[model samples]
Target: MKGLPAGLPSLREVLSRHGLDARKSLGQHFLLDPVLLGRIVAQAGDLDGRHVVEVGPGPGGLTRALLATSAETVTAIEIDSRAVLAIEELRQAVNGAEGDRLRLIEDDAMRLDLASLVPEPRQIVANLPYNVGTPLLIGWLRQAASWERLTLMFQMEVAERIAAAPGADAYGRLAVLAQWTCRADLLMRIPPGAFLPPPKVFSAVVGLIPHPVQPPPDLFRSMERLTAAAFGQRRKMLRGSLKSVGGEALLDRAGIDPQRRAETLSVEEFDRLAQLL
Candidate 1:
């Protein structure tokens, strides 16, 4: 509310003026509710003195909410040139202290190294584009040490996968990688109606706090490979599914049952197998 200039055009007006409609290919779903935007930002906890990174800021609805906070800086990355042009007004409207608080980058988030964007105490808060959300999250999980927290919104199914337990249907590579490197929690569930061009499915917000102590880089890589093989054929036993990796020999080495299915193994069990790799 206090972040943008007085009488700045509403999100819908801005989109209409810029000829911007939600792009399905880009997984864009614009959220315009200021109160909802503020609530999403709240999931990130205290932003004071922390640098925040936002990805796929379609109309800057969430970006505006982030600017309203006490964050040290908010760097927004947008792949679409049209989106960049649309939010330019919001960036220009902020003068004085808030002026320098917003930085707009026109680029792809997947290729960019987020850690290099700012120093420690950095966090990523975004309504990630649905198409690339998982890969973006995986990249962030690998470099978990670089972040203080990760507050992200994804399709409800994907969010469930990230926070799912060992036996849950949603549990898989996403959960294994996320939980292995960080503490993940399902923070909020949002309905389809929240967005300007609502998606057919619901969305949920997940908060991840990276563990202070993490496995070495090689171990993380091994875990990735292991999970891939195991879940590649979720119905098969570990011995059959993981055959390409190491098969029965690997299972014997890790002291895990050869008959166990991929979904049945806990995160710790997965780590144990990864260690043997």
Candidate 2:
């Protein structure tokens, strides 16, 4: 054990020693600030005895913080081979109890069936690569019942969309789906400069606690179809945009005004439309 402080070296030093550099193609931006990394892990709350799944553990800055937490085990999915090797060094640095608790899986997070990878009482804590964050989130939301919590980082815009409510500019399909199934909150914002190769956009951590129970079985699919059409032509009214699915008639059936725009509709309103359709 490395004692109370953990005594880990700077992420820049680790990257330089390992000959690791961020790959733009992979959307890799290593988060090097220890204070920020610690904050991300703290957002997950009481990880002791809990299993955590992390995506894109580039250079393992966040991974090291997760290890310092009380988490029982950590399964980090890294797509880049270089990152896998770098994370191995992090595993060694943590040492004892914590070191033995880490597991690094070198694979594309998008392709992995996360619901099956870890058992129940699991939490997903990660500073995800920007390129695949949304798709990966939708995949996990499809299996929302299996996991306990999701403490994730995303571009500030995306985080806002996830936490957006009815009538907000950020509200749309993501808001509907995320709100329909989970309680989401914006935890904290991180400046771009905090990263190794600072991304152009600011990022924020969002926490999503899955609903203990799900909505109607077909609610997600319906909302998906509805939003795809509604937001596909955001400037158009719902009556015009949703014509393929029943248009004004569908809204009438669902008790929603056909003149409303997609961004103005609440999750409950979307759910009602989905149920009617």
Candidate 3:
């Protein structure tokens, strides 16, 4: 199969040369298969002239694949010092037309001010660390206008939640927020053995197309609080669960049944509850 060009070291070679292993505390699971890496980039769609932001690029396996594409610039954020060192060669190898196309930052992606690094018309594509994936996604959702698409990988359960329907088992806080602000799709499921130190659960990639129809600022806050309350006590009926947030009166005002459980409420109903709150 075609893979990363001949100039840069293979991902396995980079790990070996640097004497590094995936760090569990950092949620590191290095993807060693370049073929899989190519496939993952392919899922990001045509990258020609588009800027991409990648998080947790361990050993640059997926990073190499992304750079191989036509993407104009790729800002890769990584937390591991050893892994950052490992990417130095890859960075130097990117010369000529790919000049400065790869910006490797050693920092926590969760804390990074995304606007500072990400240029307009960006897409987030990553083999995201299991620990901070959801928070990172939520942060991106808040700045969704700056991004074109979010083709992100997450634990299968988390991916399920992001793309889940109101009645599905995985649907909850993340789902409501994701579906409300973006059109989400579950692209594919990946087996555990694809990575160096394979994760226990399978992983999945989800693509989110951002929409401009988000709730107004205060209403968005209300939606978050309302989802937290409803799903916080999911088994309880809306009237009992939402007591602190106006409970039955809020339910009456929204014209939603007080007896309906949180899990059963559609995104529109959730929005109504948020608006009423």
Candidate 4:
């Protein structure tokens, strides 16, 4: 592990050989710090024999860490052609046997049917692309049952929103959904200096373990609509924001004050309002 398997070069060497540089357009910032990568993997708990799916594995940094975990399978989805080739070199470099557990998919993560693409009993671990992180999160939440856990990296602000509680400055739709459906927590803060083309902002790793008792599917769908309406005008009163959906009368039935803003509503109130939709 000190160096790569026999003939395989180190990750840094591989990237250098391929002339790969992090792309700003893709929101790419390669996490080259091995220590940090290992820490992200450790936060997901035991991966032994578990299936793992990683998205946006730029140059196979975190993907390599995941493969080392002895997981039954490690699938990496990448949209960058250069990264796809780079990861291929990694599979051959690390271990031929690792290729048995490692898989590389050349496609955009946003376009994949994530649930069916990978084997079940899977934990999604990735340093997600900054561009599509939030939308991808919402997609996963809609089908939270498919994943056993999600250990993801995001801009610190986005991570804060995921683990934030009601009434907090960062709390909103993402908070309500993440909190209600998953036991969300912030594991650690990662500094910009950790990456190759270091991003301007800091990043954080967040762990989300789906709650055993999920909300009603109908209620979940309702919450989506309610949250959309409410947070679409987050600064406005619930009465004003809810108007597009129903208005103060609906809020009255949910037993929530019309005067309250979306940021003030707890997960329970949001779910209750969702029921009205």
Give me candidate 2's TM-score against the actual structure. Answer: 0.93
Estimate, for each residue in 1-277, the C-alpha lDDT of model 2 and write its tens digit.
3222356667787788777788888878888877878988999998888989999988888887887777888888988887788887766655554455788888898888987887778999988888888998988888788889999999999999999878888988888888888999999999999887899999999999999987655777877888899888989989999999999889988888888888888787887888888
Compared with the true structure, the alpha-carbon lDDT of candidate 2 equals 0.84
Instruction: Give the runs in model 1 whose Cα sits over 4 Å from its true position.
Output: 1-4, 95-99
Q: lDDT (0-100) at residue 136 of candidate 4? A: 95
lDDT of 3 by residue, 1-277 (tens): 1123466666678898887798889888888787888898899899988888899888888888898888888888988888888776777677443568888888898888776786777888998999888889888777666678889999999999999998889889999988888999999899999877989999999999988766666777788789889999999999999998999999999999999999888998898888778
Better of 1 and 4 by TM-score: 1
Inter-residue clash pairs, candidate 3: none
Q: Record all residue pairs in model 2 with backbone atoms less than 3 Å apart, i.e. clashing.
A: none
lDDT of 4 by residue, 1-277 (tens): 2223555557788688777788888888888777878888999999877888999987788987886676888788999888889888776655464445677889998989888977778889999989999999988988888889999999999999999888899998899988878999999999999988888999999999998888677878888888888999999999999898889889888888899899988887787777678
lDDT of each: 0.91, 0.84, 0.85, 0.85
For this target, which candidate reaches the highest lDDT against the unseen true structure? 1
* Estimated TM-score for each candidate: 0.96, 0.93, 0.95, 0.94
Ranking the candidates on TM-score from highest down gives 1, 3, 4, 2
Estimate, for each residue in 154-242, the C-alpha lDDT of model 1 and write its tens digit: 99999999999988999999999999999999999999999878899999999999999988899998998999999999999999999
lDDT of 1: 0.91
